[model samples]
Target: MPRKSLPALSRRMFLVASGIAAGALALPHSVLATEPEHTAISTLAFDGESLLAGGANLVRSDDGGQSWTELPAPGPILALATHPERPGLVLAGLASGGVALSEDGGRTWESRSDGLPEGEVDAVAVASRQPDMIYAAVQGDGLWKSENAGQSWSFAMDRPWLEETEHDLLTLASVDLATGMGGIWIYAGTEAGLTRVPDCFCRWQDVQPGNAMDALVSGDAPPSEAPLPAGEAVRALASAPSAPETLYSALPSGIWTSRDGGVVWSHLVDRPASAVAVHPSDAMQVVAVLDGTLQMSRDGGATWTALAAE
Candidate 1:
């Protein structure tokens, strides 16, 4: 049976839940802080070697999710992406504004937002096959692309708008597939819904268009199984390099899994999830943020172990 969807998040709750709260600090602090110092997490990334959790701050765990150590972050990180071939290369989208690049894992970072507007970068993604190609979704500036890594950027597309208000993009991932235009697709989880654009930087389209997967030579049909719940905002998206077709999405309703690329989906965790990450090589090893806390699952999503922030 399908799990029941949770209540919709209010505008204010959505912002905080997405990791853009006003009080989010940049400096590193203890993993587990007292009530007054507690920080809410908004995103997660498992780069095969280290597990990173970002939001009001940042923390990394080298031994899976067993223990965590805080790292100095540029600011409240709204999104994170890792390079497929490079172990320590990480790109971070900052809530404060701009993007940051970390070469020695998450230990240190340098500003790499050249050419990008000084606005909250809600989402960032690195092409797995072409690490130099980076994409960022700025709060109001829309999507920006950088072919020379994050060294500099150029406008690629506009932010999604409904009625007259522009919706924010919460997450992004570069999936490796034969997308006619190229062999990869840039997937974005927006306030409006899940959309993807060929790495060619063309117009974004819904994931369910009948001919959506026409370019796919695998003969897979466009996503038709269990569709995403209407009006539920997608908070985060994570895909494993070893299992390119598999995806994990964090939603106000729960964590949904897509095994056939985006062609089909099944609800896994039946609760509001703020962020999710899968091992870069192992699709079954996963980590997710539930109710502002972190949980880990070794046997896929069948069972979970709450990782204490301490």
Candidate 2:
């Protein structure tokens, strides 16, 4: 979910049980045509043979990238994810920080973020090991979690960041233990730095060894010059299912990579991407979004495919 403008807290529960609203896919007129970069795809994923991307609205393309059809959302969606074990159970995070569930793929949606946080949604993810476990990162809030899908939620932030700064959490990435080596890894990309909690009951500590991320999460050491600048956010995060240790992050500076979990890091490129995802089976295949355009790097980062319109 794009977080340029966050709605007020009073408008938290948008239980839009009604069917798809009117003008769900209205294209802008020629007079108001904007550049492709302005409509960057905020999030991307592959659901079976279909490609789903979220930005101004949730759009789906059954025939790859040839064309796309808009799926109605309560507001500009910032986050989207599918249940690993349950097909057709698509989860969407709205700009208002509300969560919606789609039982029939993307055809219909229903708000289920009743007990969740109140703000814009930055990212949403489901654990493959524990299929029922769902997590959301609220833009102006900390973290939220739900055990029974999105029907209900609770604040999952374990530290002071939960209530101290509403805008501390920016994005999140969860790696299921069943698919990975073992043990769950929930990475919370925050303004202070990246924090990691092994499981739902573990404590959160800065993933970056000696970076400012540590200071931001621990409040022990003075700000240190880490790869991430002071107060720079970890905007988007993704991990391949085959190799969960190989993590990717879209940071304020640029794309950052971690080969052995989040231990060591190096700046990949200065071209900032809003979100990134690696092919579940192929490590070489990667996709990222710059501005509103989508691009692919099939052969590692040596070359990139052309930017495609969403």
- Among these predictions, the greatest lDDT belongs to 1
Instruction: Give stretches of model 2 more than 4 Å off.
Output: 1-38, 158-167, 177-182, 208-231, 307-310
lDDT per residue for candidate 1 within 1-310, as digits (tens), equals 2211112232223333232222223444444321111135667787657887776556677776665666666666778999769888888988778888877777767788778988888899998798888899988778999989877789998876643566777789888865426678788887666777777665666565344546344456455566677567888888778888788889988888888767678888887887888888788888887665578888778888777643
TM-score of 2: 0.74
lDDT of 1: 0.73
Window of ten residues with lowest summed lDDT in model 1: 2-11
The backbone clash count of each candidate, in order, is: 0, 9
Over 214-274, each residue of candidate 2 has an lDDT whose tens digit, in order, gives: 3544677432234454467777777766677777777657777776666666677677667
**Per-residue lDDT value at 60 in model 2:** 65
Model 1: pairs clashing at backbone N, Cα or C within 3 Å: none
> What C-alpha lDDT do the candidate models reach, one value each?
0.73, 0.61
